[model samples]
Target: MSRAAIVVAAVACAACSGRMPVLDPGGPQAARIATYWWIVFWLSALILAAVVAFLLHTLAHRRVAAAPASLVEDTRVERRLALGVAAAVGLTALTLVVLLVTSVATGRALRSFGGTDPLTLEVTGYQWWWDVEYWDPVPSQRVRTANEIHIPVGRPVLVKTRSLDVIHSFWVPGLHGKKDNIPGHGSSLVLQADRAGTFIGRCAEFCGVQHAHMQLLVIADQPEVFDAWLQAQRRSAVVPTDAFARHGFDLFMTGPCALCHTVLGTPAGGRRGPDLTHLASRRTLAAGTLPNTVGHLAGWIIDPQAQKPGAQMPGNAFGADDLSALLAFLGGLS
Candidate 1:
């Protein structure tokens, strides 16, 4: 379709979802799965049609009930019917075996993308958030972020996942299948994106009251773009410029926020919450539940429990001046 046509269609459906992830594949794994689904769907449809036609033919051609069973029975016809039934059963079993083998092969292929330079990341599932840690050979170069992941297109990624509390599945249907993060046991998945775009991921398993709000974004970018992003994320946060921001930083370091959150280059090194070093760069707050705007950020920090009933973050009773300063500091993080 032409770009204009596509744009028109998008505008027409602006109120609806933009894409169906299962059908709109951005990776080889998702493409293969969608192919498998269509194959089975069409084959089953054909089989149902065939069965219905046969039943209709049988019903249309009726036999009179004038003779006894022994008198009217034909040995050749009975043998043929038996043979047809046996053949149908054998064919059904064979089809099932083929499908099973194909599915297994596809699964194995999806998991076999390991390479020498594969990007390795650790994703930990919280009650209503995802903590993502990008691993590097140099410990100092490692990065810890939340809810957003950026990867290079066409490069393999090794994602190790674990849950802090309960089972939560990590899935971006447009890129790959679901991988469960068990509470006691860890799991890993190999995934790659063939296209450069953003995909949404959600916790497939229910963990708590905020399960539905638990979401993440996977952004696939060009290699150069990804490298640039990595370099930016690796650096420490910039120093606050204005007085309000500077004062807010001091308040954060002295208050309870310092114990549960970390801001690189500063003394606030708490690991219990998401890193706030480059918090302003992110597009969403509370695991994609709220837009990353000054207003939404203020609401989230002032009363997290009011927005998310089971949120782990407690409401901070900051005075009007303190709140303004804090918001200024956070907003200037980018």
Candidate 2:
């Protein structure tokens, strides 16, 4: 590809999920994986270099040495060649053993998490979105949100995942390895961030057309900050007070928007799509396909297919006034 096209692609990817540096881990689990990766990489590089050097040395020796007279069969030379072959075989076996042991150790370390106060999340993978449910012991205290997930820094997060439609894998290279979300089976991933920052996650498995657009954000925050955010999410959506917003709420409840999306503490509860209880609170919309802004949201509502092909949400043809009121109400969902 041309340099300009490569630059454009890089910019688009950055806009979608920033830089995904698998080697630059942000957590203990990812660090272990990265360590294993470097071990294998160096071992392979060394093996390649050794093989190339041996080939060059053999070629040079053949050119410099005279031809054997009458094919003299020397037992000493044959024994030396056999010993060298055996030594090379032994080294290869040792390398294989090292790789096997490290693989097992990394896998075990990733699965070894049983903290007393680890936060649990039920993350369901959809066709092109993520359904995140903060699993609380008390059912009423549970909070539901979409793509944006916040976890307390320096605490383990146990994520139980399953797929609602086709198989999808949840992967945040900055935190952990890929864990597939099978339809009939459930899997769990334990991740912990050592510092406060945002990490990008994506559906690692190929599910459908919009798989490329299926992205999520992992926000690591201080314990107190995460607690406050969770508490805020647990509350219901604020009832609009102004005239236009109230009218927009009425329109939302009485229109097609109520059929797929849910707004907590209201009659407009629908399960097919992402919950809009804290819609404006999220950083992105449609599983990170578009930024969560007024103009982008308006454009998505008017024509979702244009933004993301094969999206489940259909386009609408609302009048300009209705569209403004709808935006006014939805924009204040925070």
Candidate 3:
């Protein structure tokens, strides 16, 4: 391929990657932000054009015979120039005031949480993953999940955020602005999706060696679908009925795997790691580090540190048959 063809292919690949979320607004908050951005962008462009035109005009008239010595001291011309400068300054001030007011109004709109009934989600940022819990007034209604969040379309969601170890940021650029999750403190933000789609989220603040891997998915679904998903999440993990799966389950519960992770409705209730009750239901493993497939799951279980250098979970040593059984059991949790 020619150099130009290669360059075009590279650009096409980057465009297909869907990485520029800020430019593609998916919610009301992000739409408002995009509007503000465009306003400033156009205003800046106009000012730059004006400056460039003035410079070009000056260059074109550079040989106009340095203002006649007599006209250089003309009080009337000086007065006119002074008036022109004053007018320009006043106009600039007015523009600034307008921009300021627009910014303040947009900020207020973004911060407003005025829904009579909003879904509440408690998000706690861990070193390399997000611990997410769907909150409810009834204790039993609360559902615990990790890495992925589901919300109903056209409804407001109040997200309460905090950090367990260090400062982290919750940011879904297509949905809203970044909110800090500070340790020893609490912060909250409101997000609402205008349509049904899947959006990606990431930890904007640096936390540790695997900070870049701290990613999540925000799924906006129809009301019925979202409710059904919530109901499923609130239930315990499905019990395996196959003989191999049962054997794997026994090994998981009796071995070191149960020491850090929890499988709801089972004897394992460890809280130091992400919940495994709905592990197979998630799209990614190790917090978006790998696709949630049987091969990836087995690899992660055998050697987690190789995938994430600073991950908290340690690798487990299991024979080939035992590893296959364990993967089968975990994959059936959905």
Candidate 4:
């Protein structure tokens, strides 16, 4: 094939490849945006077909090529062209107005709240980690815990988003797109999942060196399962009679860890990192990027910067037993 032909073939192949196309609209807002694109695509295709057919007809029937200058412009033809342009402009404006109105309506539906019946979650973003806090507003009931957020499949979840140091985004691909977590100001995102499964989420904005490693999960489950999970999370951190776990707890509280992290039901009052109140219950550590296991947790505890560059956590210079105790104490948080 000629170079031009090869270039055309490449362009066609690129157009046909849907590898990164936004095939699925997970949320209502995304669905609306996808629908708008679909309408525009088909309409453009129809216009192109009409224009091509008209050009072919004109070329086939032309008597003398390049001799139409003597025909002169017709006033009626000019008037019809002006009317067509005006109609096109008016229709475009009307379409834009309709789209704006519908977008606002869909947004309102997504953000609608029940009268004090919805589950409220506090989602705080660190440099590259996600700090999840489930708020149980009821006085007597304890809220269950997990790193990733979980909600009932059919009910709307109200999430209040915040940031500690830099901006991060909360995005659950199969549920909702994202909302920015800006420091000093709170933003709210209302979303729901229509099905029950684990959906992958990621930090949509870059914050630091580990920004690419920061990811999260959204678990949509039946209400009963969510309730049980919550109960497990709210249980107090394990007060281990085992020497290793007890030593780890001591190392955690007395070492530099206490100055930067928080563990509920204990005196570690730090607020710089994620709350370790229920760390073991979380499926993934390091902001949902690493699996929660003894080895990974040990690595994180010993030298966090090696795993997560630019992390605010410093490496602990403790011995193996002390590290084991810390890992044991953390592992029992679930």
Candidate 5:
């Protein structure tokens, strides 16, 4: 292909890959940050233009020979230069004050949690995945889900953050700014989506080898839809009625998988891994490393390390029949 054709192809591929969340503001906090970004961008651009203009003017009016020493040290010229320097300094200070005030105001707005009883969520960052817990006054209303967060649109949601292991930053760029999840320290941020959409989130801090793949999805839905999803997530795993699924469930409960994963409403109550109560409902597995399809599920079950190098999950060797049955049981989790 020609060079132009290759360039076009590259641009087309980038367009198809979706937008970076920081450039796409889906909420008030992100919009506020974007405003600050634009202010800085325009100010920088203006400074660059002024410097370029002065350089070009100097070049165009080049002196053929050196000026006289008396003219160089002229009192009027020295006074004008001093005034120019002072004016520049004053303008620069004024500009900085404006930026500081704007930044402080925006920060205050982002931290403000004034709303009709915001939904509370505790997000604990792990080695390479997020453990999310929805908080509620009623014990039964609380739900635990991993790598995905569902929230109602147009409502404030306060997310309390912590790190189970090393420091990790919780950042959903389309919704809010990055907040560090420090061990032994509690930090919180408020998020509110103005519209319904699926926004991508990721670990902003580098924690380990699989840090690049540490991702999450924020699904903003209508109140009713969010409530339905919450209710489904709070429920326990469904019991399989079919022979293949039943056999698979028995195997899962008895096998090594039960030691790490939890299936609510069952005897398998392991806490080391992500909750599998509604595993099928999630869009991705292994912290967004792979799509949550039957084929991917089978592959992940057989050899997790091959997919995620530093993943905590070890490979499990299962026969074809058992793998098929296990896939059947897991696929019905939703």
Candidate 6:
């Protein structure tokens, strides 16, 4: 259809809709945008109403045909109009001040509240994945993991953000907001959950070719469950006793893979990419694009460029056996 027709159709559809549009008068972050819009809407409506009222009064009392030679402006009417204009401007300014103060207060509260002792996760964003490290100070331990970040519900969780390559973003809509991960410059996000659930987050900023693929997951749970998960993540690297996985482990260690990737208890300590200390424990590979399974892992290992074009990971020469062995070893890293 033509542009004019599309515009007319959209307007007609909107006119026929019955639901009240959300007027976000005040909230936080993007939610506060609606509040600003609502203020504009009401201010415009009031101004239009005043203009229409004045025009109607002028049309009723003022002479249309030019017959009177000594028509004079009324001082009282002029003063009333000036007062109305002043009031409108003052009210608009006051509204803006209130909105700004409220937003500042909300942000301060979100930053300061300490609901309970919470888990701390250090999440580093890479070109195509997220490297997650669970740090518990009380237990005096650290657990290296991948894309999925776990926390305890009803607690204030602090997340530290860093980037290995370019800048990326960490965002979880259901819980809080987005924070950028920049190289050399470290940022932090303090978030909390009201209840227990799995909240999905992603790299909100555009970092590179596979920027869209950089996803992260946050699992909020009870304290006990979170502790158990910590223990599981801290377990020694999975050594595949099976023939294929064993061969894959050997191939991974002896091949060029060790130069860029790191498996905590193994020889593959290539720090160029995300430290895959607990690779298999992660939900997705390729920075949260694909699941951490044999198929996706194998495919990514074989041809990372095909899976994520412009990925920093260079796909080198490898046969089926070599690829299979590498996949097995990486997959068993947890």
Query: Candidate 5, residue 124: CA error in Å?
Result: 0.8
**TM-score, each model?**
0.89, 0.94, 0.90, 0.77, 0.92, 0.75
List ranges where model 2 is wrong by over 4 Å: 1-17, 64-67
Number of colliding residue pairs in each model: 0, 0, 0, 3, 0, 5
Candidate 5 total steric clashes: 0
lDDT tens digits, residue span 1-334, model 4: 8999998986655323112224365545446556655766776676688679878998989876475665787899899999978986886787677667766766675565343566788888877777777777674354534358877877777888898788888876466657998889899877666668777777778787677667777788889998888777666566778887898888888888889777767888787777777877778878765689989988888888888778777888888777777887888887
Q: lDDT per model, in order?
A: 0.87, 0.92, 0.89, 0.73, 0.89, 0.72
For model 5, give the 10-residue run with minimal summed lDDT: 11-20
After the best TM-score superposition of candidate 6, give how far the Cα of residue 48 lies from its true spot, in angstroms. 10
Position 160, candidate 6: lDDT: 89
Give the Cα RMSD of candidate 4: 6.5
Best by TM-score: 2
Among all windows of 10 consecutive residues in model 4, the one with the lowest summed lDDT is 14-23
On residues 1-334, what C-alpha lDDT tens digit does candidate 5 reach at each position?
9999998986656222324568789988899999998888888788788789989998999988975866456788789999989987997898799789988988888777448789999999998999999998888778898999999999999999999899999999899889999999999999999999999888889898888778889999999999889888988888999999999999999999899888888888898988888999999998877889999999999998898888999999999999999999999999
Off by over 4 Å in 4: 1-72, 75-91, 94-98, 113-116, 138-147
lDDT, model 5, position 227: 86
lDDT of 6 by residue, 153-220 (tens): 66677788998788888877666667888899998877776667766677778776566666777777
How much RMSD separates candidate 3 from the native structure?
4.2
What does candidate 3's lDDT look like per residue over 1-334, in tens digits? 9999998986555223326478688889889988998889988898899889989998988875674766457788789999979987997998799799989999999888449898999999999899998988898788888999999999999999999899999999899989999999999999999999989988999887787788889999999999898888888887788999998999999999898888988998988999899898899998888899999998899999998888999889999999999988998878
Q: Which stretches of candidate 3 lie over 4 Å from their true place?
A: 1-20, 64-68
> Lowest-scoring 10 consecutive residues by lDDT in candidate 3?
11-20
Best by lDDT: 2
Measured with C-alpha atoms, the lDDT of residue 2 in candidate 3 is 100
Clashes of 3: 0
Write out the backbone clash pairs for model 1.
none
lDDT of 2: 0.92
